[model samples]
Target chain A: MSTEELQAWLRRFAELVHEHKDELTALDSAIGDADHGANLDRGMTAVLAALEEAPPADAAALLKKTGATLVSKVGGASGPLYGTLFLRMAGADTFPAALRAGYEGVLARGKAEPGDKTMVDALGPACDALDAGRSVAEAAQAAAEGRDATVPLVARKGRASYLGERSAGHADPGATSTALLLQAAAETLS
Target chain B: MTVGIVVVSHSRALADAAVELARQMLPGRELVVEVAAGTEDGGLGTDAMAVSAAIEAADGGEGTVVLMDLGSAVLSAETALEFLPDDVRERTTLSAAPLVEGLVGAVVVAAGGATREQVAAEAGRGLAPKEAQLR
Candidate 1:
């Protein structure tokens, strides 16, 4: 895929977030703070508005703009964490390398471990699969499996952590989202 | 060639919602946007490993960009970097823009075929103030 294609994919993803804002919030209500949907929706809405006014010239510039926007608009942990990912990716030169670097930035900022019932569980395995020469489809499948694997784990972070062992047996909304991301990638690649 | 995007966040619901919103806005755009969200699973908040994997998979020959939603998600993504090859690492870009502005910037750039630098710069622009206020 070309850099341009990658950018389009990101735009589509933002739109999807806007479309299902309500549903996502509802999911969060099950085991986390209800603001998940609302927060992301608001953030994406702002993103769309910015894009409408002026588009960037390159992938790095585009992502940099996005990072700045998120830092200013989004609150809580999500803002800085997400913002950092874009900032790092923008610094990168190519899509694959940028992704690899971006993931590293996420790990440095978020401080989460694998099997923690976090998106990391799915993401870590997926990266590993890709490294192993697996196709994007295969990697995505692994991500899905990783997401489902969270069902039996307990919550160790965020509001869900408050539930402690009670968090177990519940599918993590974040992991599920990660699975969707992989699916989207697969679709685009195909 | 089509491309894919990944939106990362602390909450899975938030990530899902972001994806849904993207779908609604650009129904005609030939791109795919995915979500990589962290859950309150017992181990940690967000899963860097999962996020890294998603990014790797999203990578078409052109590569992919990752947008994250705070805390451990970022940390996990960073950790996952070790697993990526140098070539893939070279293509990736990460930023710290506001979530909404960043998402929009990325989409617009992607749709328009802008470069990574351009997208990052736009994201830096953040949300504009109300027009009326400017006057």
Candidate 2:
């Protein structure tokens, strides 16, 4: 997708979060601090406000704004990890390359690996799929599958890790959200 | 009422999810919200080009505020500033607020065409804790 199209994808994703804040919070309650939904909701809300005040001049600035907001407000591992991801991606010039670079930044900053039952499990594969020249639709499908794949793996990072083996049964909230993002990208680009 | 909102997240899915939620919230509103998402796999976060374009789009008439998720995002955003034209950059404001609250609040205000000052005030408000209990 072109950079403009990619921006639409992000807008769509934010809309989804608003719609499902309660559900996401509920899911997070099971294995996390029970604030995932609320936290994300709150964060996005601020993002919307920030945009209204001073709209950025380009895609990189927008993403950078997002990353900083999350880090400063979220107040958890997600804040830093996700923040770094955007910060890095904001530096890239293309969709695919930015996607790959963003993923790598998340991985490096979060210090999580594939199969650790973290969001990485889903994200890792999705990046690979996109890198393989898969269509946005195909890549999004892969991302959904990757999110689902998190169900059986053991949590080794973030709050899910606190559950240990018990975390195996539940889907990672981050991963589920990741899938939704890919879906938005596909929809907007398509 | 022309307002711009930005979504930032580590997971593309998460950012996309937020966007979807926003669409549902104001189905008929002619608001402009943007997403700056991180990669799915282990790579860097958000695309600079995407963020820059979104900012440029927001600069049409109403100004914009850039919201981000974390440290690196803030840093990268600082770097991306170079890509924007002086005028557009002058109209843009960057904040470090909570993602969810900031985004939702901004959507509501921006959709209503709140002034830049009003929007910044709302964005600042998002940094505070929410009163709702986590169910």
Candidate 3:
């Protein structure tokens, strides 16, 4: 996607996060520190403001700035995790490449594999769909499915992991947020 | 200038308190101790940019050693390193120790003109006293 389209995607993601802030926080309360929604909302708001203050010259610069803003504002595990995704994705030239790079970045930062009941659970499937030449819409659906799949698996990463078997039955909050992000991309980028 | 120390935590008050406690541990000794904690709004969280700035500010020509409170605090500290200049990054280290204990140990050692490596070692051993006392 072009820089303009990417910026649109980011704005859409922020809107979605703001709209679902309470829901996201509720989900986090089940398995995390219950601040994901407020944290992401604050970060996204700052990102939008930053974008307006000093517009990025290119897609890479845009993503890099977004990453830095999130890292500085989000103030939790999600900060570094999501920050790394966009920062690494800035290096890619294609949508699929960007998704792959983003996923790899999360892995490096979080050290969580697929089925860990973390964001990787959703991000992994979305990247897979994108790699298979599926449309962004399809990738977004895959991400949602991946998030749903987390409900049955015990968490092995993040705070949810501390719950052990009790982590099962609750949807992974990070995975749910990942789906929101990919779905935003599908709606805006496409 | 001796080696510097940075304390990272999810709470600003906790970081500040830890620094205060460490300073008390080394009264009359002047050592560079920086704090990077909480979100911009002073809520519970960790900020990598703040951590990076704290590390830079803490640096007194000697290298800096960082001690973090929890999981994400560690991650933020690592991310902070990426924002540091290459020369500063090369000298910085993240100590694998508990926060309060480690900072007190690190500050005491650094106040004595210890090297970064030596400060880090003392911080890593900070938990040993408690462990021994429990035994």
Candidate 4:
């Protein structure tokens, strides 16, 4: 993707994060610290501000800056997890490959699996779809489906895991946000 | 003769208080303790970039040990290692120790001229006293 397209993806994801901020927080309140929405929103806002301050020269620069901004400004598990995603993406040659690398990074960083009722649930499917030569829109759809699938899984990672069976009925806030990210990529990069 | 320490907590006040408590363990000794806590906006969270800066600041060339408050704090501290210089990063350790208790033990051990591993081990066992009390 071109730098402009990547920038658009960031803007789209930031806007989505803003719109869904309360919803994300509500979900987190069910099984977590109830700050995911506010945290990601703050991080995205800073990301946009950073981008505006210095427009990046390439996709790598844009992704690196975005990742670093999130790592610094997000200030939560999401910060390192999402930051690793974009940072790993910065070195990959293709968007699909980047997604794969980013997914692996999350898996490594979080030590979470697809059935862990974490972002991996959504991100893993999206990566699989994209790696199989699916369109970005299709990958986004896969992510949404993966997110929906989280409602039935017991928590196995993250703060949510503390609740065990009590966490089964709640949708994962991280998966919800990851789906939004894939959707933004589909919207802007595809 | 000291292993630097970094306290990563979600609350700035919490980190400051913990540092104070830890520092108190050594009345007149030199203990390198740094805190990377809360967001820049004064919110409750852990900033990896801040943790990275703290790691560098806490390092005394002996090594640095990180003690974190919660899950995010641990993740942020781990991520912070990526931002450190190669040699400095090589010696840094992220201790899976409870915040308050661990910091106190780490500070005490560090002040006594222990290595980073020893300090971390002391921190790891900080929970022993409490657990023994409960038992």
In angstroms, the error of model 3 at A108 is 0.6
Candidate 4 TM-score over all chains jointly:
0.98
Candidate 3 segments whose C-alpha is farther than 4 A from its true place: none
Q: What is the interface RMSD of each candidate, in Å?
A: 9.9, 9.9, 0.9, 0.7
Cα error, residue B15 of model 1, in Å, equals 28
Supply DockQ values for each candidate: 0.05, 0.03, 0.77, 0.82
TM-scores, all models, native as reference: 0.55, 0.57, 0.98, 0.98
Cα deviation in Å at residue A142, candidate 4? 0.3
Answer with 1 or 3, whichever has the higher DockQ. 3
How well is each residue in A130-182 modelled by candidate 4, as lDDT tens digits?
A: 98999999999999999999998898887898998999898899999999999
lDDT of 1 at A49: 69
Q: What fraction of the genuine interface contacts, i.e. the true contacts, does candidate 4 reproduce?
A: 0.71
Question: Relative to the unseen true structure, what is the C-alpha lDDT of residue A173 in candidate 2, on a scale of 0 to 100?
Answer: 80
CAPRI tier of model 1: incorrect
Task: Classify candidate 2 by CAPRI docking class.
Answer: incorrect
Candidate 3 TM-score, true structure as reference: 0.98
TM-score of 1: 0.55
Give the best candidate by DockQ.
Answer: 4
Worst 10 residues of 1 chain A by lDDT: A71-80
What is the lDDT for B48 in model 4? 92
Docking class of 4: high
Fraction of real interface contacts that model 3 preserves: 0.65
